[model samples]
Target: MSTDLQWLLLRKYNSYMVKGLPEGPIFSKEPGNLVNIHSHKYSGLSNSKTIDVSDENGVIQITTRKTASPHTIASTRSTSNIRARSGGRRALRVASAPAKQGYRPDLRRATLARVSALLAAQKEPKAQPAKKPRGKKTKASA
Candidate 1:
């Protein structure tokens, strides 16, 4: 996925799940469990299964696991390709080609009738003709 899409996914994921947790842990080498990531500063608890993330007063320690959220993987797979095209460029191209003149008469006739009528009106004599100045600039005819 593109960096822009990744950033968008990160933002969306953070908005829905990361506000309660510290900002630094979101991008850490190993993220903890949901409780660890969403706990306050003073909720300290350390063990082999969890890491202690404490703030400056030496009082608040948030417990977290060394794992990512289940939603992260699922969301990435779902939105990676979708967000790539939303960057305002050539993201999606139709697989089917436009129906040719003799390919589908029913559809072609329905569409071309309107187009042909418009074209015929434009071709009438009243339409402006291409011309140039006819005096000095005119070359002698052979």
Candidate 2:
């Protein structure tokens, strides 16, 4: 997804980070460029992209990619494909951090963002109208 488009998706999902990283990965070297993602827990990469990291300065310009179309019930196989795509893309764009940086992502924030976004987007089903009460029976006019 393009920068504007990703922002739209985030809005649709409601101010939350998609997938499993808090606002995706951040490279200390650059401040406004994005890096791709792979879930260590799941053993694969994701198709989505991250925000751009600028210079050592604290500013960052976020961006994203389509990765996957709007599909419900995504299977494990397809999800794995997304992860691989994400990892490869990241490898190309950003250089890896030094060993001493000790990269540990903010999983808690990511989970909260995803859950809140999803819940807010969910629409409740419409309720049925109530039936009217019937009047008492009357004798025949004959």
Worst 10 residues of 2 by lDDT: 76-85
The global C-alpha lDDT for each of the candidates, from Candidate 1 onward, is 0.30, 0.29
Write the residue-wise lDDT of candidate 2 on 1-142 in tens digits.
4545544443333322245456755222221112322222211122233223222122111222224455732431211111222343342222222111232232323422332333333335579897655554223322
lDDT of 1 by residue, 77-113 (tens): 1111212223222211110111232322223332333
Provide the RMSD of all predictions against the true structure, rounded to 1 decimal. Answer: 24.5, 18.4
Best by TM-score: 2
Model 2 TM-score (2 dp): 0.18
Error (Å) of candidate 2 at residue 128 is 17
Which number leads on lDDT? 1
